[model samples]
Target chain A: MREKQIDKLKDYKYGFTTDIENIRAPKGLNKEVIEFISKAKKEPKWMLDWRMKAFERLKNLKEPNWQKPKYPKIDYQDIYYYSAPKSASDKPKSIDELDPKLLETYKKLGIPLQEQQRLNGIAVDAVFDSVSVATTFKDKLNEVGVIFCSISEAIQKHPELVKKYLGSVIPLTDHYFATLNSAVFTDGSFVYIPPGVRCPMELSTYFRINASQTGQFERTLIIADKGSYVSYLEGCTAPMRDENQLHAANVELVALDDAEIKYSTVQNWYPGDENGKGGIYNFVTKRGLCKGINSKISWTQVETGSAITWKYPSCILQGDNSIGEFYSIAITNNHQKADTGTKMIHLGKNTKSKIISKGISAGFSDMTYRGLVDISSKAKNSTNYTQCDSLLMGNKCGAHTVPYIKNKNPESNIAHEATTSKISEEQLHYCQQRGLNPEEAVGLIVNGFCKEVLQQLPMEFAVEAQKLVGISLEGSVG
Target chain B: MLKIKNLKADIDSKSILNNFNLEIKPGEVHAIMGPNGSGKSTLSNILSGKKGYNVSGEVLFENKNLFELETEERAHKGIFLAFQYPLEIPGVNTNIFLKTSLNAIRKANGEKELDAIEFLKLVKLKAKNLKFDEEKLNRQLNVGFSGGEKKKNEILQMSILNPKLSILDETDSGLDIDALKTVADGVNSLRKKDNSFLIITHYQRLLDYIKPDYVHVLMNGKIIKSGGPELALELENKGYENFN
Candidate 1:
C-alpha cells in the first residue's frame, strides 16, 4: 500500500532536480536587485532605465486578489529575483562549449540540445533557471534572414527590433506581476520572421526552472513581418519542491499585414503534492496584436500543472479582416487550482474571433474558465463566437464558466455558449463492460469532452497533450 | 463453460436473486425468459461482473472464480454483455472505441495487437456483413444513433470481439423486425461449436430466429421450469402469467 501511494504520486515524470552550481544575485525585490540583473546581463543603459521605471511603478502596485484561486501572501522581498547556472554566467558561444550538466538536464526533459540528437526540423532555445544556455540552428535561421535567438542576445544584436516591439503588446505597467516581470525579467526566446519568408522549421523554446527558492520571470517577444508566417511552441517544467515558487512570464506577439502567428504552449509545471503543500504560482500575461490588415493570431495552450494558475492569453484585433482564435484545455487535479481563458478585443472593421475553452476538474481541485469578448462600435460587421465547456469528475471539485461579452456596434454579432457536465457512471460502466480500465475510460471520455480544443494543437503537441490529460487524472478515480 | 451454485444477490438489502442455479456448456445456446422484475437483468449483471450488488455463492467460468474478477477482467476472460440501454458516448469515434476495446482484450490474452490497417479491415468486413452504414463508423459512438442503429452496432461489436460466452440482455427490446433478423443473422454467423451464448429476454421472438438449445422460465429470482424450444412456443401461447 505504501509503495502504491508513492507510485501514484510518481505520475509527474519530470520531477527531478539537477545538482549544478548557480550564481545568485541578492534576494528580495529592490532597485539594487533589478540593477544586479541588468548589469549581470551586460544590458545597455536604456534597458536599465526601463527596469527602473517598472520598479518605480511596482512600488505602488498591489497584487491582485480578485482571482478565484487564492494563495498565501508572497513576500517579494524574500524571494531571489535572479539565479543562473554558474557555467552560464559568461554565456557559451556554441552548444559544444556549453556545460554538459545543462545539456543533460534538457536531455532528461526529453528536449535534446545536441545537434546529432536534436529533434527533426525543430529549432530549440533552452532556458535553465534565469538564463538561456544554448540555442540551436542559429546559422541556418540566419540564412533566411530569420533571427531566432535568446532575448538577451537580441537586445545586443537586434536592438532596434527589440526596442520597437518589446512592450508594444504588453506594456511595462500592465499589472502587478507583469510589472514585476518587466523589472527583473531574465532570459526567454525572441524570434523575428522577415517579410515573405515562411519559417523553414518549427521554432520552439523549452524552459526549465531548476534552482530552489528562485522565482522565474522570463519575457518572450515574437514579430512576424509582412506576408510571413511562423509557428512557435513553448514547453516548461519544474522540479518538485516543498516551497511554493513563482513563475511570472510575459509573452508578446506582433503580426504585420497578411502575416500570421501560431503560438502553442504545453505547461507541465510540477503541481504541488496531493495535499497542495507546494507548487508553482503561475501568473502569466500573454497577448498578441494584429497590427496590419489581414493579419491573424491564434493561441493554443494545454495547462495541466501548478498549484494556483491565473492567466488569460488575449488578442487585440486591430487590423481589418484579421482573425483571432483561442483554443485552450486546462485540467486540474489533487488540490490544484486554475483560472484561465482568453480575451478577444475587436477594434477594426470585419474582425473575427473564436474562443473554445475546455476545463476539467478532478479530486479536490477547482477550475474556472474566465474569458471576454468585446466588439467595439467602430468595428463594423465584426463577429465573435465563444464556447465554454466544463467537466467535473466528483462533488469535491468545482468547475465554473465566467464569460464577459460586449457588443457595441449594431452591425456586429457575438454569440456565446456554455455548458457543465459530469462523467456519468453509465458511461464508465459501459466502457468498462467493453474492457477498458478505469483510468483509460476516464481518459477517453475527458479527451472526447475536450476534443474541439485539442484539435487546435499542433500534431506533435496534440499527442503529448492527450497523454498528459490521462496522466493528470491518474488518482482521481475511485 | 459456466457454472453457478446457489448464487444470491441483493442491492440495498433488497433481494434481487436467490438460490439461482444454472450451467452452460460449450456449443449450447440457452435462453432465459422471464417477466418484468423477475431478476433476469440481475442474473446477467452478476455474470458480467457489474458492481453494487451484495453477491453470495460461487460462480465459476472454466474452473475460475468469476466473482474475484473485475468487470474488465471478466471481459478479458471472454464474457460479453450487450446492455439493454446502450450508452451514447459523445466525441468518441465508433471505430476508435472498437479498436481500443479489441486491442485491449487481445493484449490481455497474450496475443499480438492489431495495427490500424488490420483493425480497420476487420471492422470494414464485419460492418459490411451486418449491413451497417460505413459512414456511421466514423461518427461519435452511439451519439444521435437511432434505436435500431444502436442495436445493430452492438451486434457488430459482438461479432468483432468474438467472445466465448455472449449474454444478450434484452437485445430485442427496441429492435424492429428487420433489425431483429439482422441481429440474429449476426449472432448466428458467429455461433460455433466452441462458442456459447446465454440470451436473456422477455418474449420468445428472438429464440425463433436463433433457436436456443434449451429454454428456462425464471420467476421471483428462481428457475421455476426448464424445457427445450417447445417450451418457448407454449409460453408464447399461454403467456408468462399462466405458463407455470
Candidate 2:
C-alpha cells in the first residue's frame, strides 16, 4: 500500500499540454513576416530600418557549434515570430485597464499586479508574452532621475542613450541565439541609474510566456553611471506544457567608474515530463562590462527547472582596480541537461575576479560546468580564483567539469579548484537516524552544499529561491 | 528496555561484533569500557540503525523488532545516538535545528508539537544549564565550533530530545575536565525511572561524575568481563591486557 501511494505521488505535473488558440505565421522565413510584424506593431521608420538590417545579418550568420548538445536543424520559418496577449493593444496603462484574462493569468501565477500598493520596496515591470503589461513605481523612480521602463519605451523616450550603448558588450554577431535575439526581440526591461545616486529599492522584471507555439526573444540593457549603484533581479515561469518551447534572451550591463551592479536570476521553466517528452529549450547570452576605474559587477543565478539549458553570464574587467564575481547553483533531475558556467576576462591592472559554482544531478540527469579565465598582457598584478564542485545524488547521473585558463601577464596570480563528490549512503543514514525522512535529508544536504551560492542572492529572493530548490527536488530522492 | 542476542556484524566483509549479547533494563546506566578495535562504536551505530553494516542479529527495543525499522523509525521509537564526530551542517541555525528535531520526535510519539514560546523557553533553560552561550545557538550548527563546544551541543540535543534510551559514543574523547563534568551532570539530570543509557568510552574519567550501575569490558569482538561500577576503576588502573 505504501509503495502504491509513493508511485501515485510521483506523477508529473507538466505532462499535459494546453490546447489554446494560436495565430501563427506561414512556414517560411521571408521579408513579408518582418514587414507584417513591424506593421502589426506600427513601429517607426528607423526601428523598421534597424530590424531590416538585423534580419539581413541573421540570414548570413551561421549557427554556433561550440555547445555540447546535439539538435536538429531549426526551421526559422516554421516558428511564429510574433505573439501577444489576446486583446492587447499598443500597451496598457493600468492593471484594471489591461485584458481581464491576461490579468487572471498573472493572478494564477501568484504575481501580485497591484505591487505598488502592496510592496513599497520593490519596483516591478510585468511582461506578458511579447509586450509589457504594466510598470509600477514609475513616478518614484522618475523623481530620482532614474529610468526604469520597457526597452521599446526607452528607445522612444531616450533614443540617444539606447543607441549609444546598445550591443556594446554583446555584439549582434556574438552567437547564433544572440543574433536571433538581436533581430526579432520583442520586449524586455531597461534600467538606467544616474551618477552619484544609489537606488533606494530593488528593481525587478517578471517574464511570463503565455501563447503556444511562439518563441520568446527579449533584450535587456542596464547602465550605471559614475559612482552609482543598483541591484536587479529577473524571474521567469511558464505554463505547463508537453511541447518544447524556445527562449532566447540577451542581457548586457555596463558599470562606470566606482559603480556597482549586482544581478540575480531565478529560472523555473517548465521541465519535461518523466518520460523526457517536452520542456523548455533555454538559450541565453548575458554579459557585463566594467568600463570605469574601480567598478564591480556580480552575477548570481539558481537554475532548477529546464529541459536543456545553455547559458554563460560573464564579466569583463577593463578598468583598473575593478572586481568581478559569479556565484551559480544549477540542479538537474529526470533527464534534464544543463551546461552552464561563467567567464572572467581581465584586461586592466589590479583587477580581481572570483567564481563559485555548485551543480547537483539526480535521476539520470547530465550536468556539467564550463568556465574560462583569461588575463591579458596589460593586466599586471591581476588575480582570479575559481572553484567548481559537483554533487551526484544517484549512480545513474553524470557530472563533468571543463575549465579553461589563459594567462599572459607574469605578475598575475590565478588559482583554480574543482571537485566531484557523491552523496554517500552513510551521510543519508546519519541524517535519517536523526528523525529526518530521506527526502528531507537530501534537501538538507543539498542546501548545505549550495549555501555559498545561495547566500549571494538578495534577502527577499533568497528565501523564495531556497523554497524553490526544495520543491524542485521533491521526489528525485527516493 | 533493550536486548541484543547473537549479534554478528561486519564492515566491508570484516567482522566487528561477533556473537555479542547484552541486555539493559529500565532506570539503569551501563558503561561499556573497551580497548581500541573492540567494536564499542559499532554496537552503538547498529543500535541507532546506521547503514553500511551487514548484520545478523535479533535486537529488540521496547518489545519491537529493531532490524525491520528504518533509522528514523528507530529514532521515533525513543532511541538516540550521540555521534563521536558530530557533523557540521552549514546554514542551519542551531536553535532552529534543535527545535525541529525535538518537535519531530514529539510528533512521532503521539504528542502535540511545541510552539515557538514553549520551544524557546525549554531550549533556553537547557542551554543555560549546559553553559552554552546564547550567541552560539544563533549561529550555524557546529560550524567552527571547538571540540569541547561540539560535545556540549550533543548533550544539549540529548537533553531536548529526552529519549528513553540514549547511546553515547566516545562523548568524552576531546573534552576537558570541566566540560566532561558538565556533560555528565547534564546526563544525570535526565535520568528517570523509565529511561536508560548505554555509555561507550575508552577511559573512566566520565564515569567519575555520573556513576554507572554496571560495567562491561569488551575485547576483540565480544565482552570478556562484567562487574559493578568498581570494574571501571580497576580497568582504568590495570588496562585491557588484564581482561585478556
Candidate 3:
C-alpha cells in the first residue's frame, strides 16, 4: 500500500510538455555547431572565437566521476546542441508582438512577463529553452549604471567586460559540467553594477526548458564593483517528459571591495513521471568570489523539484573582512536523488563563512549533503560555522551528510554540526490532531524542518517554494 | 457533552487505560487525579485520537461516536486536548497556527471562516483575558517558550478552539503559581453553559484555581476511587501510597 502511494506521488505537475513549433540543431557537437549557434545569433567575430576555444575544451574534457550520482555517458552526437522557436530572432518589441503561445505558457507558469514591462523599477530577463526571449527594464537599470542583458548580447556588445570577467572565478576546468557549460552555453543573464552603484531593484531571470532533445547550458555572471551592491534571483522550470533531460548551467559572482551580493535560486525543474520514468538531471556549478576587503556574498537556494539534482552554489572569501553564507533546502520524493551542498574557501584574514543546509527525503528517494570549509594558512582568525540537517519522511528514504573541513590557520574558529532524524509519527499525529490532513501535516513538518533556509528566500518566492514542497511530497505520507 | 464507556487502550501491547469510564456533561468541570504511571495522560491521548494506541470501547462526543473519526475530525467535533508537552513547531507562528486550526474546525462545522482582522481581534481579546503577552501569539508556536509560557499557550489554544469538551492533560505541571493561576483563570473564563472540561493533574493545587465539581483517582489503569471535589485534597494529603 505504501509503495503504491509513493508511486502515485512520483508523478507531479510540470511533467507534461506542450506541443509547439521547435527549431532544433542536428544531433552533434563540433566547431561547426558552435559557429552555427554564433551565426544564428549574428554575433561578432570575437564571440565566435571564444565559442571555438570553448568547443576545443569541451572535446578534450572528460565526464567527472567524483560526485555521488551515477553519471550515464551522454551522447553528444545524439543530442541537439541548440533549440528555439522558429521566429526567436525577431525580438518582440512588446507583449502584443510576442507569440501568443509563448505568452500563455509564461502566464500559466504564473510569471507575468507583460506585467513586468509595466513595472518600471524591476528588471526581468526571461529565458526560454536555450535562449533569452526578452529583457525588460533595461532603461531603469541603465540609469543606475547597471548593465543587464543576455550573455549572447553582452558577448557581442560588451566584449571587453565579458573578456575580463568570464570564467575568472569558475575556470574552464573547474568541473566537468562547468567545462561543458563554458564550451556550449547558449545564453543566460549577465549583470554588471559599476563601482559605488546600488541596483535600484531586484533583478530576476526566469528559465524555461521547452525543447525535448536540447540540454540547457546557461552561463550567468554578475559582477559588483567596489562599494556596489546587487540582489539577483533565478527561477527555472521545464516541460514534462518521460525521458530524463539534462541541465548543466554555471553561474559566477564577483564582489569587489566593500561590495555585497545576494544570489537566490528557486529551482522547480520538471521531475520524472510517476514510476520514475523520466525527469531532469540537474547538474549546475554556481560560486561567488568576495575578492576585496569587507565584501560579502550569500547563496540561498530552495530546490524542491527535479529528478536528480547535483549542484552546490559556493563562495570564496579571498579578502580581509570578507564574509560568505550558503543557505539551502533540497527536497526529494519518489525515486529522486539529490546531492547538493556548498563550499566555503577562506584565504583572507578575518574572513567568515556560514553554511546551513536542510535536506528532506520522502518515498524511496536518497538525499545527501556534501560540503567543505577550507581555511588557508594565510586566513588567520578566520571563522566558519556549518550545520547540516536532514528530515527523512519514511523508512524507505535515506539521508546522509558528508562534511570535509580543513583548517590550516590555528587561530581560526570553525564549528561543524550535523544531524539526521526521521519525522516522528507522533509529530504527524499532533499536526493531524490540529485539523491538518496527513499530507498537509507532512508538509507542515517538512516546512518547519527547512524553516531556516526557507526564511532566507524572498517573501514571494518563499510562499511559492512552500507550495512546491507540499506538491512535491504530496503522496509520500499516509 | 462527552462520554467514555469501558475505554480499553494499550500502548505497544501494554494496556494503559483498562475499562476506564467517565462522563462529562455540559457546564461541568471534572478533575482526574492519579499517581505516576497511571493512565491520566493515556486517557487524554486516546480522546485526542493519537495514533499507535490500540483502543477499544466507545467514546461519544456531542452525541456522536468519536472513535470513528480521525484526529482532526475529532478536533472538528469539538474535542480538544491540551497536551502536557506541547510540540514546538518552529517557524509556525502561534497566531497563524491557532487561526488555521480554529478556522479549520469552524469550516468543518459549517461555520464561516474568519479573516485576519477578525482573528486578530478574537486572539487579542483572549490573550488579554489570559494575561498572555500578545507578542507570544506572533512567535513560532512554543519554539523557545518557557514551561509556563507553553502551558499558557495550551490555554490560549483551548480558548481559541472553544471546544465542547476540553481535556487539560497536566496543563499545570511545570507552571509557577502565577502561570498556573493564569492558566486556570483562562480555563475558567472559557467555561460556558455549553462547554465542559476534563482537568487531569497529579496535584490538587490546580483545582484551587479552577474548582472542579467532581474528582476521580485513577491508579493501575483504572479509576479506583471517585467522589466530590474534596477527594482531590484527600489524595494530595494522604498520597496514592495509602490507596494503592
Query: TM-scores across all candidates?
Result: 0.98, 0.91, 0.94
List where candidate 2 sits over 4 angstroms from the true fold. A1-28, A115-117, B5-21, B90-96, B106-125, B133-140, B143-146, B217-227, B231-244
lDDT of 1 by residue, A26-140 (tens): 9998889998999989999989999899999988999998889988889888899899999999998889888999889999999999989998899999998899999999899
RMSD of 2: 3.2
Backbone collisions counted per model: 0, 0, 4
Fnat of every candidate, listed in order: 0.67, 0.50, 0.53
lDDT: worst 10-residue window of model 1 chain A: A1-10
Point out where model 1 deviates above 4 Å. Answer: A1-7
lDDT (10s digit) by residue, model 2, range A200-267? 88898888876666778878999999999999998887766777788889999999999999999998
Q: What is the interface RMSD of each candidate, in Å?
A: 3.4, 3.2, 3.5
Q: Candidate 1 — which pairs collide?
A: none
User: What lDDT is reached at residue B28 by model 2?
Assistant: 90
lDDT winner: 1
Global fold similarity of model 2 (TM-score): 0.91
Better of 1 and 3 by TM-score: 1
* Candidate 1: tens digits of C-alpha lDDT, residues B1-244: 9999999999999998899999999989999999999999999888887778999998999889998787888899999998888889888999999998999899989999999999999999999999999899999999999998998999899999999999999999889999999999999998999899999999889988999999999999999898999999998999989976
